[model samples]
Target: MGDPHPKIEARAVTRVFGRAARAVHALGPVDLTVAPGEFTCVVGPSGCGKSTLLRIAAGLLRPSSGELRIRTNARRPAAMIFQDYGIHDWKTVLANIRFGLDVQKVPRREADARAAHWLDRMGLTDFAAAYPAALSGGMRQRVAIARALAVEPEILLMDEPFAALDAQLRTILQDELLGLTQTTRTTTLFITHSLEEAIVLGDRVLVMSARPGRVIAERRPPFPRPRTGAVRATPEFAALTSELWELLRGEVGAGAAA
Candidate 1:
């Protein structure tokens, strides 16, 4: 039977660290849901538990309280991309692409086919033989992203995946990632500090408060898709981004103070 639950669901999920006197509440009482094939962008100030939320969702860290449910099938589990390019210096671009498929025990030929597909799709065909060190920062991140997508995961969690690159390269990679996600229809939760990045990449942008973070506001961008060029110039886009900034300003200052 088809699953009735959301692709990803979190009910009053919270995370705290340390004892009573030194306790640091890192996240919720947070509630969140990402529908199948939806791309939701999360934004907040530094140290706002945005990355903490992703780690919890990715199953890397257990929540101290609340229920976090991820409905994933055997063939398509969740995958993650961190802010740092998660690639192996020793592995060739093509080998990195094949990493996840190999882990799944996919047949050699089929794994090669799938990895090759992503490498080409990500515009890394020319660099297929190169190691991570031989590639530029943007190229390495693309390899990381391609590897995650190559797994054909039902849900993808990314924590500021493109934050390391220069502005121009970041934009290019953003477009590439957006196009790939559209094609795959993968359910994704993307965490970023850039409001424009969130707006550009998200179907809905969730803004969180400072430490002990929680979603304080959200913007479901009405901008039409293929969200490529020229959309950011529109008044509506500006208005929505501005609203998001206003929501985040105080939180950013608070984060800075503490």
Candidate 2:
């Protein structure tokens, strides 16, 4: 069983862009938590501050009101993988993977060893010398994952990291991620628009409303872990997906109507 204490916690967190009359209430009064070693996914209508909440968790953005608590002894605390891959064009695949380890001041030889391990794991060993320009979309995303994992972050935050890939590639990476997270037991918070993806990847799926996003519903799939594409074929999977969509449909429609 995972720790009862929250690895990540938010209390009435909110965000607003600009001031007064022009102020755009982007998120919250949202409250949520992720237990240690848990994989939690968030789904919401477009422009619903899913990314804003993620940014707050990543400490890249501060909430306008309320608080976020991330409990980790590690210096970096978290590693984030973005949809854009976020690797440097100037660095080789190997360098990109080592970048975070280096920042942690992991020794040179240790960093190289750790980077090499992830390169092999991500199947990027062949492209170790190549820059981001040389890799395919899926390959680039793998590199991004490798870089994030190499740091051994206490919490992993992903913002639709596989969303841009084709369906086939997305499934492949999803399984790979499931396997890695299961093995490492890294706490993760993922954001996606796909209810199927959220159901497939998360231990619990959180649904958010349209703009000024607030988590309005949550669902936990009954299927057991080491989950893969095989789970999608089960009736239970379909039922859960339908259930989450029912909760989301109105919010999505409202966002569209707005």
Candidate 3:
């Protein structure tokens, strides 16, 4: 079911890199809508432009054609969490978490309150004074997530935020993220290479085709929300995985070849 009121709308959005001489078609004139509080994940082959799609939505890149609108009724923009954990090494964990609020000129009292809340939720209260260098990859990503969420944006865009973590920690963060997003009901557009991650975290999972990417399949996991990693063990999860693998595996190989 779609949200009666959508938070993000991408209409016939297309992205191309470079000019005529050396052009690369990145994404589609694909239409996408994110309902407030919905978590939508996209999975595709390597060159399929999953990240490109996110960049356009984040307003980091303008679509080559068509329009991408954020919170149509307001001006609030989306916040993005990157795979590399884009936190400043010179800043303390708390400081990094509060950076967005600071930029927006949020009052110190309220900014501090928001930062502290997210740090605690992200399980980073103990590392508030630590720098990015001192934290594990997983911990660093938590800070990145905390920083993004602290701003309380209507839309969240994530680009493989957990792809660098060890398998065990990735699983842990995936569960934590699932819980956090569901609790907040934040609308999210996440990109991932892992099909399991896509199915586990997304209320809906979108599969994209090769370069010049366009959504080829959309899967709505029938499982109820509040998903923990344990859901990955179910028969339903396996079936979904198998179904998507057929569409994604060749793309994966194709992506690698490219």
TM-score of each: 0.96, 0.98, 0.94
Off by over 4 Å in 3: 1-3, 72-75, 256-258
User: Top model by lDDT, which number?
Assistant: 2
Candidate 2 segments whose C-alpha is farther than 4 A from its true place: none
TM-score of 1: 0.96
After best superposition, candidate 1 residue 136: deviation in angstroms?
Answer: 0.4
lDDT of 1 by residue, 173-253 (tens): 888888888888899999999999888889999999999899899789887776774667889889988988999999999
Best by TM-score: 2
**RMSD per prediction, one decimal?**
1.6, 1.0, 1.8
- Candidate ranking under TM-score, highest first, comes to 2, 1, 3
| Worst-scoring 10-residue span by lDDT in model 1 | 223-232
